[model samples]
Target: MKKSTKMMFFTMMIIGTMITMSSNSWMSMWMGLEVNMMSFIPLIYKMKNNKSAESSMIYFLTQSMSSMLMLFSISMNSMMENKMMILLTISLMIKMGAAPFQMWFTEMMNKMSWMNCLILMTWQKMAPMFICQMSQEKFLMSSALSTMVGAIGGLNQTSTRKIMAFSSINHMGWMMMCTTFNNNLWIMYLLIYSTLMMPLAWMFNEKMIMHSSQMMTNMKSMTEKMNITCMMMSMGGMPPMLGFLPKWMAINSMMESNMYMIMIMMIMMSIITLFYYMRITMSTMMIYEVQKKWMMINQNKNMYTSIMLTMNLLLMTMMMFF
Candidate 1:
């Protein structure tokens, strides 16, 4: 793709996301989504191959399905008044890939570039998240259930992208649970989660190639290895890190609200999720994967510096939390 075309494509995506996020009505939301979809198609094709095409198809289909559901729910709400609540809840849940609707997330993560994965995981979420906030009361119970599913689903993934995808879903659950509390706390959680997660994903993308089993092979220096390892722990919500701050608050909030069952479930789920993150951490830091004699690892100074900077910021942010 030409540089001019790439520039135009990203410009349009940002514009579309902004418009959709600012939409007052459901129709405008759909329009924004359509623009985002169209702009992203070219970027997806930039890879130029069968697998990329297949991945684009899957993403397009799922995104279209979710958009249709959102439109249907909006129509349903306009007709039935009270029924709008349930439909809106269902639509946004579908959009966010919460629970039963989450298969597309993992599938897409596995197929796309790490950069694409980061965008899909973070930016694409804003619209549904905003919509979910609007239908807070109607969606509370469904939100809790989806959160539980997200927490558990992330526990077993081996692919790094899938792990981040599930982690996003898990955080979505925790954020949804915050809807039961005050707006101030909810916004704070969102900011903190975004602060930590975006850098984490960016760090991962800078260091690891998609479909590669482990990233340590790509790390050329001890500093790079240490940075990546610390990042894995930060994403796992380890204490003294910004990631842990939100989880701690969620647990405290759940307990205060007397939601013992959900809190306990979350605790167990966290433990399960932590195991996989630790596995990746070990691979990247403690136990190096020995490559076959014939295999070669590429080391680019620019990529190494970029990832090292991201990892440093993540660690530095966590340090600030303490």
Candidate 2:
């Protein structure tokens, strides 16, 4: 892709975000979403690989369907003298790839490059989540169920991208829970998540591939191993890292709200999540010189530096709170 084209695409995504923020009507929100989708299609194609193309197709179709459903729900609400929170909530849940509709997320992650996966994981999430929060009273059940499903589903993913996909879904549950609390918490969670995740994606993107097995023997130095450990721990929501902060805040907030049932459910699921995270962390940290020879490609230094630096800083930041 040309420099001009990249600039143009980003310009449109920003415009779409602006439009969605300014508008109360669903029509304007739909337009903004289309703009965002259109902008990203180019980034997906920039890789020029078949997998990228395939992932792009799936993402576009799924997003289009969700946008259409949102429009239809809004129209229906207009006619019914009031909004049907259930329909709107379901649409938002589908868009966010929450429970009962999370297949698309896992599938897309399986097919995309690491960098593309990162973009999908982070940037693509805000709009749908915002829309869902807007109608909190209408979709609380779906949100609650999505939280449970996301936590459980992430427990067994083998692929790195699939793991992150489920992690995003899991975190979505936490983010949704925050909606019931206060706007300050919601914004804080978003900020902290974005701060931590951008580097995680960058770290993985340095590798280009999405399988933990592929990374088993790639790093030769002790420094690289430690950096990877930090990232994996951050994702696991372990103490002394930024990731742990959100989960802790969320649990405390839930308990404070007297939502004991959901709180206990989240705690159990979180323990399950530790297993998946540990699998990756173990691979990255302990597989330095395993017996079997594994085929690997040239390491990308630029990608590695960015991920390492950003993640270490995030880890350090989290440790300060301890």
lDDT against the true structure, each candidate: 0.70, 0.72
lDDT by residue (tens digit), candidate 1, 114-230: 767767777777766766665656345655666666667766666777777887777777777776775545666777766666656666676664433557666545556666666
Q: Candidate 1: give the clashing pairs.
A: none
- Name the regions of candidate 2 deviating beyond 4 angstroms: 81-83, 289-322
Instruction: For candidate 2, give the lDDT of residue 87.
Output: 66
Please give the TM-score that candidate 2 achieves against the real structure: 0.86
TM-score of 1: 0.82
Best by the TM-score measure: 2
Candidate 2 C-alpha error for residue 280, in Å: 1.8
Worst 10 residues of 2 by lDDT: 289-298
Candidate 1 residue runs with Cα over 4 Å from true position: 182-187, 211-213, 288-322
lDDT of 1: 0.70
